[model samples]
Target: MTKAANFIWYELMTSDPAGAAAFYGAVVGWTIAGGADPQAGGVDYRMIGRRDGGNAGGVLALNADMLAGGARPCWMGYLHVADVDAAIAAIEADGGVVHMPATDLSVGRIAMLSDPQGATFYIMDPIPPAGAEDMESDVFSVTEAQHVRWNELATSDPDAAIAFYRRHFGWGQDGAMEMGELGSYRFVQRGDVMLGAVMPLMPGMPAPAWSYYIGVDDIDRAAAAVTANGGTITNEPMEIPGGEFAMNAVDPQGAAVGFVGPRGG
Candidate 1:
């Protein structure tokens, strides 16, 4: 199968790795393990493992150097591309900015980037694991709890954002929803699979950003767990299409996140 240009990994950079691990484990039901190990360059990096199997993402210790450099507690998505250098050039040509140029890592080459609207993410050309035929799928199905279920983008210029991605990543318009005064909610897809949507940033929203939604078994229960664990529920569970519910929230370390699942409250 041809590798699609998609989000291949997700990560959270936070000031309190232990606090974040405890909070998200309770809220998302992920098994957080390993910390301050010599294996991770001795930087206190930890893995966010899903209950079902495989790693869901990672949590990196936010150090003083990063904090001095204006880095805050935030969630970042790593996009998979065939060529990192080529993707960087395309991004620059499209009015996007490159925060970090392509650099080699143990896993692959990565470049930190932001859209024309200033929504930051990573673009990477990953090295396949030993004995694996190909890189595992990064985005997960909606039916599975404890995995990424949706990818959403809120940009100042939705039309321009959509065009930029389509031009660079080969994404297509699957469908759209009219949002009255808020403009159109456009669904973006690769081939027949709908990955996510782009919409105009609502008033009071920080910067143009991508919010990933993780699947949960019970929306109400998860929302409660979020609050109980020191995370804030920014948006309560609300019904969406297909009888599932969705919500917006902030993790304990302050990374914005989303959740989707069956409604109970």
Candidate 2:
């Protein structure tokens, strides 16, 4: 089967890796392991493991040099592509900026890029482990708890963003919801799966960015946990179309994140 351009991994670049790990562990119920080890390129990278024994994503500790270079704490999603070099070239031709040139790693060839509207994400061509060639990534799921359920893009130009993503990644606009002055909330889908939505940047959103919403068992409990752990709930938990509640939050390290689940009584 041909590879589809879908988000296969999520990552958090934060100043305090240990604190961010603890905060997410309490709020998202993820067990983080692996720290800065000289054996692993001396990078302070930790793995985010879900309860189901699958990896949700990873956390990379931002160093002083990264901060000096204006790298802020943020959550980034990696979209798997079949050809990273071709994707990078196409993206650049379509007004997208390539922040990091395509480079080969032990696991894959990857590159960092931003949409025309400045929403940043990564494109990776992953290499499966030996004998696991047929294994699919479960880091993104629409209903499973602890996995990313949604990948939302709030952009300065939704129409152009949609067009660019569709042209390059084969995403489709399944439908849209009218949001009055805030504009339309356009749902994006990859084949049959409803990935997430795209909407205009709301007031107080500093810039165009993507927000990955992780699935939780209880929305209310997660919202409370956000505050109890020094994180700020930007949007209160509210019912979405599918009867589940969702909320936007800012982690203590200043990265924006989201959660979606049932609001248990």
Backbone clashes for every candidate come to 0, 0
Local lDDT at 61 for model 2 = 92
Q: Which stretches of candidate 2 lie over 4 Å from their true place?
A: 1-4, 37-39
Off by over 4 Å in 1: 1-3, 37-39
Task: Estimate candidate 1's alpha-carbon lDDT, on a 0 to 1 scale.
Answer: 0.85
lDDT by residue (1-265, candidate 2, tens digit) is: 2333789999999999888878888888998874763434677887888887889988889999999999999999999998999888888988999999998876789999999999999999899999999887889998888999999999999989988888889888978999999899999998999999999999988899999998888998998889999999989998899799999999999999999999893
Which candidate number would show the highest TM-score if scored against the true structure?
A: 2
lDDT digits (tens) for residues 1-265 of candidate 1 = 3345777788888999888888878877887774764546667678888876788877888899989999899888898898999889878987999998999877789999999999899998888888885656654665678888888999999988988888877888778988899888899987777888999999899889999998888899999999999899989998888899999999888888999999763
Best by lDDT: 2
User: What local lDDT score does residue 178 receive in model 1, on the 0 to 100 scale?
Assistant: 89
What C-alpha lDDT does candidate 2 achieve relative to the native structure?
0.90
Q: What would the TM-scores of all predictions be?
A: 0.94, 0.96
Query: Pairing residues by index, what is the TM-score of model 1?
Result: 0.94
